[model samples]
Target: MKIKIVENEQQLQDAYTVRCEVFVEEQGVPEELEIDDLENEAIHFAGYDDEKPVAASRMRLVDGYGKMERICILKDYRGKSYGKELLLFMEQVAKEKGIDKSKLNAQTQAEAFYQKLGYTTISGEFMDAGIPHITMTKNL
Candidate 1:
C-alpha cells in the first residue's frame, strides 16, 4: 500500500470515494454530514492498493493545532494496518507544518484504536451524525 497527498481533483475524488464507501455506505453516516465544507481548506491523503484507492484521511489547521477528520478505510481493506498508516502520515504532515498537537473526534467504538495510536480522550461521549463519539488529542 502507498499513501499520497491529494493534489488534484482526481485525487480528491478518489479520497471521497473511499470515504463514501466506509462512512456513508458501511456506517450509515448521512451523505450531507459526510461531505462537509472543509474539503477545500483541508489537506487530504489517499492510501492506495496498487492503483486502487483504499483508505483516506483529511487534516486542517484549527486554532494553531492540527485537526484530523474523515479518516476511513474500505471494509475489504481493514485489519491490514492501512488506517494506522494513514493516521501516522497525517500526524507527520502536521508535525512538518509546525503543529505540535492534533485532535480528532473518534467514534466510541474506535476509541481504543486511537488510543493505541497515542491519543487520549478529552471529551465525554457525544452524538455525531447519530453515532457515539469522543474528542481525542495527541501531541506530535
Candidate 2:
C-alpha cells in the first residue's frame, strides 16, 4: 500500500470517504462528530492500494505531542496489516516534524493493536462519539 499526504481537495475527500465508511456508516459514529472543525489544522493521510482507499488518519501537534485522530481501515481491508502500516506512516510523519511523542484516544476494541506498536494506555475508558475509548501515548 502507498500512503498519501492529503495536499489537495480530492485527496482530502478520499480520506473523508474512508473515515465515513469505517467510522460513520460501519461503526455508528455521527457524521458531524466524525468530521469536526479541526480538519483544517491537522495533517491528513490516506492509504491506497493501487488507488483504492483502504485506510485514513490524521495527526496534529497538540501540547507538544503528535495527536493521531480518525484512524481507520475499511471493513473489507482489515486484518491485513494495513492499519499498522498507516499508523507507522503517521509516526514517521510525526518524527519528520520534530515531534518526540505521539498520542491518541483509541477505541477500546483497538487498544491492543495500538499496544503492539508501543502505545501505553494513559487513561481509563471513556466515551467519544458514543464509543468506548482510552487515551494512549507513545514516545517516538
Candidate 3:
C-alpha cells in the first residue's frame, strides 16, 4: 500500500474518479455538485493499494483557510482506517501550506470520525445535498 499526495494530472483524475464513484454514483450526489468548483487549484491526495486507487480526498484554500472536501474511500476499503490516514495527510498538507486551521463540512454520519481527530463542532446539523451535515474545525 502506498499513500501519497497527488502531484500530476493523472493522479488528480484518479482521485476524482474515486470521488465520482463513491459520491456521485454510490451516494447519489448530483453530478453537478460532485464536479463543481474543483480544479487545478485544489490540492489532491490518493491512497493506492497495490497501485490501484482505494481512497482519495482534496483540499482547497477558502478565504485564507484550508477546507478539506470531497473525502471518499471505496466501499470495499472502509473500516480499515484509510480514512483516518487521509485526514492526517490533509492536516499535514494544510500546515505545509502555512495554514494553522482547517475546516470541513462533514456528513452527519462522519461527525464522530472528525471528532476523534480533535475537530470541534461549530454549527448545528444542517442539510447539504439533501443529507445532514455539520461544520467542523481544528487547529493544526
Candidate 4:
C-alpha cells in the first residue's frame, strides 16, 4: 500500500468517494453533512492499494494546531492498517507545517484506536451527526 498527499482533482474525488462510502452509505451520516465547506481549505491524503484508492483523511491548521478530520478506510481495507497509516501520514504533514499538536473528533467506537496511537480523550462523549463522539488530541 502507498499513501500520498492528494494533489489533484481526481485524487480529491477519490478521497471523497471513500468518505461517502464509509460515512454516508455505510454509517448513515447524511450526505450533506459528510461533505462540508472545509474541503478546499484542508490538506487531503489518499491511500492506495495497488492503484485502488482504499483509504483517506484530511487535515487543516486550526488555531496553531492541526485538526485531523474525515478519516476513512474502505471496508475491504480496514484490517490492513491503512487507516493508521493514513493517520500517521497526516501527522507527519502537520509536523512539517510546524504544527506540534493535533486534534480530532473520534467516533466513540474508535476511541481506543486513537488511544493506541497516543491520542487522549479530551472531551465528554457527545452526539455528532446522531453518532456518539468525543474529542481527542495528541502532541506531535
Candidate 5:
C-alpha cells in the first residue's frame, strides 16, 4: 500500500467514501456531521492499494494548530498499521506547514491507539454524536 496526499477531486471522493463507510454507516454518525465543511480546507491523505483507496484521514491547519479529523480505514484494512502511517504523514504535513501542535478528538475506544502514537489525553470524556470521545494532543 502507498500513502499520498490527495490532490484532486477523485481522491477526495475516495476519502469521503471511506469515511462514510466507517463513520456514517458503521458508527452511526449523522451524515450531516460525518461530512464537514472542513473538507475543503483540510489537507487530505489516502492510503491506496494500487489505485484503490483503503484508508484515509484529514488534517487541518488552523491558527498554526494541526487538527486531525475524519480518520477512517476500510474494515478489511484495519489492524494493518495504515492508521498509524496516515497519522505520521499528517504529522509531517503539520510540521511542513509550520504547525506547532496537533490535536484530535479520539473516540473512547481508540484512545489507547492515539496514546500509543504519542498523543496525550487532555480532556474529560464527553459524548459526541452519541458516542464517547476525548480530546488528545501532541506537540509537533
Candidate 6:
C-alpha cells in the first residue's frame, strides 16, 4: 500500500470516494457529517493499492495533538495491514509537523484496532453522527 498526502483535486476525490463508500454507504453516517467543514483545515491522506484507493483519513493539529478524523477502509481491504500502514503514515506526517500526540473519536467497533496501535481510551463511550464512539489517544 502506498499512502500519499492528497495534493490535488483528483487525489482528494479519490480519498472522498473511499470514505463515502465506507462511512456514508456502509456505516450509515450522513454524507454531510462524513465530509465536514473541517476539511479545509485538515491534511487529507489516501492509500492506494495499485492506483485504486483503498483507505482514507484526514488530520489536523489540534491543541498540540494530531487530530485524526474520518478514517476508513474499503470492505475488501479491511483485514489487510493497509489500514495500519495508512495510520502509520499519518502519524509520521504528524511527527514531521512537530506533533507528539494523536487523538481520535473512534467508532466503538474499531476501538480494539486502535488499541493494538497503542491508543488508549481517554473517554467513556459517546455518540457521534448517531453512532457509538470513544475518544482515544496515543503518543507519536
lDDT of 3 by residue, 26-129 (tens): 98999888888666678888989898998988899887678999888999999999999999988998999899999999999999999999999999999988
lDDT of 6 by residue, 1-140 (tens): 88999999999999999999998999898999989889999999999999999999999999999999988889998888887888899999999999999999999999999999999999999999899999999998
lDDT of 5 by residue, 1-140 (tens): 79889999998888888888999988999999988776788888888978889998898876667999888899998898989988988898888877879999999999999999999999999999999999999998
* Model 3: residues with Cα > 4 Å off, grouped in runs: none
Q: Which tens-of-lDDT digit does each residue in 76-108 have in candidate 2?
A: 889899989999999999999999999999999
lDDT of 1 by residue, 1-140 (tens): 89999999999999999999989998899998999988889999999999999999899999987999999999888999999999999999999999999999999999999999999999999999999999999999
Residue 80 displacement (Å), model 2:
1.0
lDDT score of model 4?
0.92
TM-score of every model versus the real structure: 0.98, 0.98, 0.94, 0.98, 0.95, 0.98
For TM-score, candidate 5 versus 6, the one ahead is 6
Q: Estimate the Cα RMSD of every predicted model relative to the unseen true structure.
A: 0.7, 0.6, 1.2, 0.7, 1.0, 0.6
Q: Which stretches of candidate 4 lie over 4 Å from their true place?
A: none
Report lDDT (Cα) of residue 73, candidate 6: 89
lDDT, model 4, position 20: 96
| Candidate number with the higher lDDT (2 or 5) | 2
**Candidates 1 and 2, the one with greater TM-score:** 2
Q: After best superposition, candidate 3 residue 139: deviation in angstroms?
A: 0.7
For model 5 the TM-score comes to 0.95
Predicted candidate 4, C-alpha RMSD: 0.7
The count of residue-pair clashes in candidate 1 stands at 0
Off by over 4 Å in 5: none
Q: What local lDDT score does residue 76 receive in model 3, on the 0 to 100 scale?
A: 92
- Model 1 Cα RMSD, 1 decimal: 0.7
